[model samples]
Target chain A: MRITSETVADGIREQLFTIGDIPGVLWTPAEGSGPRPLVLIGHGGGSHKKGWEVVSRAFPYVTSCGFAVAAIDAPGTGDRPEHPEIRRLVALTQEREAAGEPFWSGPEWPALNETVAAQLIPDWQTTLDALRKLDSVGDSRPVGYYGLSQGGEMGIRLVAAEPRITAAVLGLVGSDWLTETAARVTIPVEFVLQWDDEGSPRDSVMKLFDALGSAEKTLHANPGSHFRVPSFEIDSSIRFFARHLGGPGTASGS
Target chain B: MRITSETVADGIREQLFTIGDIPGVLWTPAEGSGPRPLVLIGHGGGSHKKGWEVVSRAFPYVTSCGFAVAAIDAPGTGDRPEHPEIRRLVALTQEREAAGEPFWSGPEWPALNETVAAQLIPDWQTTLDALRKLDSVGDSRPVGYYGLSQGGEMGIRLVAAEPRITAAVLGLVGSDWLTETAARVTIPVEFVLQWDDEGSPRDSVMKLFDALGSAEKTLHANPGSHFRVPSFEIDSSIRFFARHLGGPGTASGS
Candidate 1:
């Protein structure tokens, strides 16, 4: 692991780092130096690690809960070098979308996601292994994952395979292909759905929520299109993570 | 209105009162006086004004938000005289339950609800009128309603007819008869749904939620039976009401 750059502002310390070929960013309370809870945020499709959705949630987890938060660019996003296959698949899906046709029904949609997940999921596991060794984010602390849309699509697969994640806030994607994978997720979950989401219909999202094998999972559905998720949900997520992971000064994990 | 009994405990002042023939109870912060936000709680079927569900939410609203909370006994329940028609309908529904049959599918269920609503709706409106006149709960403050199950059945009707209520936390019911009434309620709402509820199936409840006209409505669906709504929901409601009605010591309403 290598730290490439560092900056501090608004009581938060931001570090840009790389583990092997994968690039990522981590945020922590500027004043704290000890191990604390960590939340990994996954950005949506076509967005980089520092996308608005990722930074919005990361900033709060750092400032309010005094936790370390991190985000990594996917295989062809952000600072990463472009891949030919991913570019071809994205262009095909976008062509369908531009013609006012359903893009997700085509084979390219799942193909694109599969290609990204094959690389990003392993990248995330490697990132976690390296991050836990750091003094400020030791392995003893509880871990959480927050992702929506494409992030949620990948999160179900990641959380199901990863044992370190104890809680998650995932939703906004409703791929039928993920049913079996979703059933493997037993951690407490807070799933979100957009009532009028065009790409991910409410029923499809609800079906994924029902498939979750967790004993404690709650679905929070609000009105609007996919991108119009109400801001109050951010406040709700803070409380959800606080309750499950415990805050800075509280007893979290062994 | 006559205050037949008064007591103070745990920083909450409880007043048992009667508005004409309606028996009711009111709770408020013991440390403060004068007008504040008021929340009217409607009890479930077979439960009275001070039912466990009502007291649990009322005490928190009073102590946590310093808001005045009140609950009134529906017709043929609590201090009210028995109605032979209501008795017959309940007996029929109980028999269906004993026989392992779906009681809500039969006419007796709607008949029982209609019998209760006939008298209770007018009584509630009259009670609200009298409560708002009290010095401690003046008409100028914003009002909210909390009810579930049988309470939700009646609350949908009440909130629809009464324009004064600005917000409500209602669920645990899916009466198809109330679909049109639910649409008339345009205030902000926090709707709850118990995923595995026997009587109120998740689909039915979701349908009712879908019919609600409130633009700011949110659906919170948790995995549990109808009566097993998690305790955290109570804490969530406190925040919901505080945000909508404004807490005591805050600039609430004119």
Candidate 2:
């Protein structure tokens, strides 16, 4: 875990770091005395680790409640070098969209998306391993995850495979390609769905929530497009995480 | 290829035989002499070799047009044993559909479909190798393929890998998840598309047709549902095969 740069602002400590070749960010409460509960944020497709800047603003409130937050760019997003095949797909998608054509449902979309998502699961898992070793972070801290769109899609697999993630907030995603993975997730989950999402149909999104195997899961559906998630729902997600990670919210070793 | 059973029905000689473990059937004009152009047919998902019966009725007409037609069951269909995983998926699809739900867009659909399609390409190729060695069949014959839905999907892979297939009629199927394979197909192709297909959205189907690398390709679009393709289109397909494989269409080795 190598810290490339560090800054302290308004009593919040932020650092840009790398785990081997992976670029990431870690934000911790500056005035905290000991280890604190940690939350890992995931950004959507084409976004980087800092794609959560506005969401990171909300993290200050989380840190105020005694927790740390961290995130890394998915492969081909952020500071990570772009995958060649995904780069070609991005170019093709743009070319089609510019020509007033459909892109997401095109012939190559499913295979390309699968290729990218397959790379994301292990990228996140390795980042989690490194994040666990930082100062004020501990092995026993109850870790949680928050991501939307691509993040939410891959987060299903992340949460299921990583026993450390006790709870997760996955939003703006459906379970179409990941049904078997969704069925394997037994952690507490807060899944947000957009009722009128054009990308993922309403019924499919509902079916996704239905497919989750978690005994304790909640659906926070808002009547909006895929991009405009209601702010109130965001508040509700914070509260959901707080309830799950609030008490004794300290990392074990720090 | 040993002919296990030979029967004369309605002036068509139907012979059932096995090429090693692969079971198949051949249909030719009962009264014809010498070799004829050969056409290979592929069955769809959850359907066996006999699934071509309706098409076979049409095949007798094709045999009357100076061609021999044959079909073999795809993996997990007909005489081939049902793959345990696909059997589970079929049960799950049925269970969901029986509950007034959408099974095809669910999470397991892509993975299940891919598993079946992957097994189909080699299966069809091996059957082709055997069919080529039969008495009325010739190694140098100009071969064509006809398949819809799952068969259409896997046929893309077969036509690309098996240079023996000089032409094909891939109908009522959209080209997602197989665009790479579709791009590799450079032979003459006659693709069918439905204007209002509930299963395959029009734009995606159009995009799939656009992705084909064939220098000489034609799209036959008609306004119909996925299942209700007009009979006239079927006649057009037979004519297309007849032109590509009839009369002077002599196998290179015959």
Best by TM-score: 1
| Per-model TM-score on C-alpha atoms | 0.97, 0.48
Consecutive 10-residue window with the lowest summed lDDT within model 1 chain A? A245-254
Candidate 1: residue A238 lDDT (0-100): 92
Error of 1 at B152 (Å): 1.1
What is the per-residue lDDT of model 2 for residues B1-254, given as tens digits with 9 covering 90 to 100? 77889988766778888777677888776764555667788777767776753355346545546577888877677787757888888888778777887666676677777777677777778887777776576665688888777768777878989998998988566757777778898887877766568777766765676678886666655545777665644655676676677662443221
| Candidate 1 segments whose C-alpha is farther than 4 A from its true place | A250-254, B250-254
Per residue, candidate 2 scores C-alpha lDDT tens digits across A120-232 of 77878888888777656666668988887877887887888888899998867765777888989888787777756877666676567667888666565444578767554
Model 2 alpha-carbon drift over 4 Å, by segment: A52-58, A96-102, A248-254, B1-254
Clashing pairs in 2: A35-A251, A36-A251, A176-B107, B140-B251, B140-B252, B141-B251
Relative to the true structure, how large is the alpha-carbon lDDT of every model? 0.92, 0.72
In DockQ terms, which candidate is top?
Answer: 1
Candidate 1, residue B70: lDDT = 91
